[model samples]
Target: MAAVRFADGDWAEDAEFAAYGAATPALRALDAETAHDVAVAALALGLGPRRRRRDGEALRVEALGTTFSNPIGLAAGFDKDARAFEALLRVGFGFVEIGSVTPKPQPGNPKPRAFRLREHGAVINRYGFNSQGHESARTRLARRRDAVAAEGDDATAEPRGVLGVNLGKNKLTPEDNAADDYVLGVENIGEFGDYIVVNISSPNTPGLRNLQGRKHLSGLLRKVLDARDKNPGTAKTPVLVKIAPDLTDAALRDIASVVKSEKVDGVIVSNTTIARPDAIKAHAHGDEAGGLSGKPLMEPSTKVLHDLYKLTGGKITLVGCGGIASGEDAYAKIRAGASLVQLYTAFAFEGPPLIPRIKRELEECLARDGFKSVQDAIGAAHRK
Candidate 1:
């Protein structure tokens, strides 16, 4: 009896030790949206361990004609309001993107639109680009900029980590006038952003994906670029289009042609996906009517990134996103031709702690691969 008791005690200790060693539990606590808010608060308050000891090394990457202290950035949909800029930057991200903010504020889809599939390390969201509108986002960003500037620590302080504003048309906007709505967003919020992303790929928004058709996409890009030109002293806000991963080879080629002809700055290789594969077969919410992110998205999105890289011939910058949860994932995107990478679903599964972890892993990966810097790794896979 004593021997059995001792064995059980030993097993318990091992379990406890393993739990302490793993970083998954804390990351899985908050639900998708709530976890995002909590992370924003933590970053704003500087609550987490400043230096993630586990992160292997540091990497600096440049993209869209701007310099980033590191290659990891917060993808859009994390801070839709632009309210947590300071807090997110404080968390040590290389860049922070806010909004898919529309010209008018709207409550996204009905509740319970976000779901978690823990076993797959995935989330499905049909947020429909719910936003507080450009006016509100612009107002908050303007105030944040003033506060940062007032601190008077311009040199040593972070440049608020390259603010990128993602723009999308309002739900009610017709396809014919989508360009007008996009222009409204560009004209109103262009000055506050380091760059502007034209989002036409969100699966939740009604008929939004239709804008990706070549004719419509070309017109929208032209108008948005023209709007940027009209804004004087507003250093040409590099315009990039965010695309959907479900597009076929022909569709991708058409969009790539539009990007080149319009001279757009870059492409966020993908938004989330509506397709579910065998990998997520056992998940209950697999059929949910929204885009699936996290591990389920990695392969499909990376394939899209590779495709875009080839189609564009590496001319335009590519920001790979979807299902990236670690340094290895980010490294894959970078080597596949992404100039930079962003994350959202991984944060849902790994928590804020994952940021520095990924950065560290990426650095180690660079060293292991004999690349001196992140730029050296870009398209390494495709080059072969």
Candidate 2:
């Protein structure tokens, strides 16, 4: 773990890159899952070293009725339990998503389910919605909400950073009953989150992806939205659906239609894919039976994001995920049509230093293109 320094500062050029080479490999020496736990613990204790890059006005993005300090957010799987979101925010992410929490606690798939494709800068995991469940997460989230409210504006003024909960049903839940678990999550955790994500895309859970089908999707979203509207004094939280990159174009179009008709707030353009690209074939874990994330997923995922943008005519906000490793990758997503982009594998591989590096490069990319802000860069390629 990096030492905690009270003085806020950015990394020295030589020091940051040296830390990157040492960081991921050191974590990889331990088993994949154990390394993940250690990282999460470091964040919860506020010992995680972050390179704080002050966002230029060009980096701030307004979406979903809130201002994002930057368009880059930490993706869901990184902090699945919501225990360390405040610490993560302090790490300089515009937002940090936690959970995929189910209605009931689950142990998830058997151990050794997470693998590192080091040569390929990717990971394959069949974590199967491993969640601490809704109750535990709700309490944690509610506490953060109450504490932040108590702090009242005296809290750091960084665009009131966003906290999103990505909800998934328990592994034991049958397909037909999945909606029940999702609704249960929204009812229990919605009021505490800036937004809620209906995660029907993870390929690990049996029949979970089936829920993405139009029939299942519409019903599930309607019930979840109804739960939100019925929350007595709670503000209406935006709900988004996460999809897999493996879907066919027809399937993608169907999803876009459901999102539009259901009045969903946004789409998280992809989840990790189950497909193994040929480039990673030589890596021993290349054929691992799990959803894959990292460098190889960049193009396919961005293509889907771009397609979804055109399919929706840029009507819905899109949070692009999968294979984002640098500012250029992030910039590509924005130009492809992502209003916001997410980081997980990049955060894991490059460490916290990557956050500021991305923020700086992204703003530079926007300026180079003659755009005023990240928002102006959204869908730039499509507009061209």
Best by TM-score: 2
With a 3 Å backbone cut-off (N, CA, C), the pairs that clash in candidate 2 are none
Backbone collisions counted per model: 3, 0
List, residue by residue over 207-288, the lDDT tens digit for candidate 1: 8899999868888888889989888735567988999999989999999999999999999978989898976765788888
Pick out the ten consecutive residues of candidate 1 with the lowest summed lDDT: 1-10
Looking at model 2, residue 86 earns an lDDT score of 82
TM-score against truth, every candidate: 0.88, 0.94
Give the best candidate by lDDT: 2
lDDT of 1 at 178: 89
lDDT of 2 at 177: 85
Model 1, residue 188: distance off in Å is 1.1
